[model samples]
Target: MWGRSVPSAHRTGRWDTGGVASCFGSTVEQTASPGRKRGQPGACWDQTGANGTKRVADCRHESHTSHQTRLPQRSRTGPARETPAINHSGIKRSFTAWRASRRGKGLDIGRPPEHDLRSIMNAILYVDRTGIPWRYLPHDFAPWETVYGYFAAWQKEGVFDQLNGLLRRLVRETEGRHGEPSACVLDAQSVKTSSNVPAAGQGIDAGKKIAGRKRHIGVDTLGLLLAVWVTAASVSDNAGGMHLMSHIAATHPRVTKAWADTGYRTKAIEHGARLGIDVEVVQREPGTKGFKVIPRRWVVERTFGWFMHHRRLARDYETHPHRSEAMIHIAMIDLISRRLTRESTPNWRDT
Candidate 1:
């Protein structure tokens, strides 16, 4: 009975294992005694033979134990992977969307039958971003020569000047017809330039009181750039009074009050009076030994800060003054677009 006891039908097949059946076609039968552990070592059986004839065999227990022991433990957590960085396609799509918006408004002509507006804008953006010389603009963005040609053509045609005026007017009209600003903030900033540009001659040098050119800007309360004029650095602020106010009066007839610093005290007051504008020059305390910046004069300074975002405006890069002014208009367009888009979006306050 101890010699490999096989279980009968009444037994739940367990150890005291005995004969095996055919292993072919995957099903192999093993017989074990009643109430014995089926997989106990040295007590299990398997059969292997051909044509329904089977051989009884003991499965090597040591080999089975060793095989189980060699398997490596698996982790409960899953495998590792990688993540992507930037979406270049998304940026391209945004640029295309912006361009399409402009085209829908008839503001963008894919290209000039002679010169393309899209290419012109790209060149201007490139130049402004890089602060590079116009001649150095890459050929892919319309020839640098062509970009300059169109730039000059637009300036002489007064397109930039007109655009600046139009933007200010539109903003004013939309803001409940406030009408032209009665008061304007005036400020001047020095734009350092390459020594290559000719120095201001005697009278011009005497006027600005500096070595090179200076840019005087006038801006209204809403930060709209009104008039921009370039003169020699040495030109006294008061000296250009007549010319500057003339430019302002021509663009904005309703300007009645002018605000300026002490440098513009006399002439701005005189010009304002003549144009029916009351001049309000922020006065500095005479006895104050320390240099103090004026507060109300900062509006124009803020507009200059806006322009500085365009790298090209940080310095005057153009060989001609008017071309430099055109770049300013392009910067204004960018600013207006951003402002308008923000205003148009819903829940802008939460954003």
Candidate 2:
């Protein structure tokens, strides 16, 4: 009860009032050690029992030091249930209809596939949403090589593109619109590329200050993707826009009217006009300050936002621009399929 002064050397160690040794993250009181120098931080104490037995306290945080206060052994009942972020029933059910349609079209060939179609789709979606390298896919899914093979096969055979069309039409019809849109919005986004992307395929966008590739997409009023084109960032908006509008003209001929930003000013307009389509540039009001949403253009911007929700589309990782376009298509297909199934879009956050 009487204390002239509490020295700083022994400040870190406290006197123990409780003699029992307890563990499992319980507080440990250390007996104060005189001359507890800055470099000498360990505290050990000796206690005498009523039986005249001497008990040594060996509590220390250093390696290889053992203490009587041990934590309980883990129950080790079993591994936790596997909750896949992209392998939910909603996605599988939606894909089932597309697979059935393929069967109806006599799309089957050769022997049966080695891996389950459902597992392959799950692996593909997992890679897209998490942006992990193919080799890094979890062992619980199919082999990474098989998954990539299916992904590339789907792209090369136009299976993904057709699936995208089916999903897009379904979403449009779900929203009370015709399967084909009469009006659309067009836009481009420049994203940096991964190192694996060849220098020949990469370019610098002086406008957005991004050095990589450009994504030109046309979307309907509901923000569903109509077409996507990936090119080097060096390509001007006019060029990308022409390519994009031509795609819309060929596929969604009903999209007679389209809206774009100021970047697609002159040549794109003429190109669209020649294609029997009218392209309008939605400009922000002159006096507007920060982040004003331009009419008929924000929809395409929102579509781009949707692409970013899938981590693979956050940057250009594909070695070929065509594959980049395929990746984007997969993202959109995942989106529209979920929409048709009335399920929430699978996101990395849930993983």
What lDDT would each prediction earn against the true structure?
0.66, 0.79
Query: What is the lDDT for 237 in model 2?
Result: 92
Q: Roughly what TM-score does model 1 have, to 2 decimal places? A: 0.60
Top model number, TM-score? 2
lDDT of 1: 0.66
Predicted candidate 2 versus true structure: per-residue lDDT over 1-351, tens digit per residue: 122353343254554323223434344444444444333334444445887634354334411123323435557554565554675688778878887786778757777557778889989989988899999999999999999999998899988788889888887787787999998898899999999999999899998899999988888899988888888999999998999889889988888898988998888999999998999988888889988778888888889888888899898888988888888888888888777766784335756
Q: Assess the local accuracy of residue 265 in candidate 1 as a C-alpha lDDT between 0 and 100.
A: 71
lDDT of 1 at 192: 66
**What value does the lDDT take at residue 70 in candidate 1?**
68
lDDT of 1 by residue, 244-319 (tens): 6778887788787678887787766787688776778787777877646667787777788888777888876666
All candidates' TM-scores? 0.60, 0.70
Q: Which candidate gets the maximum lDDT versus the true structure?
A: 2
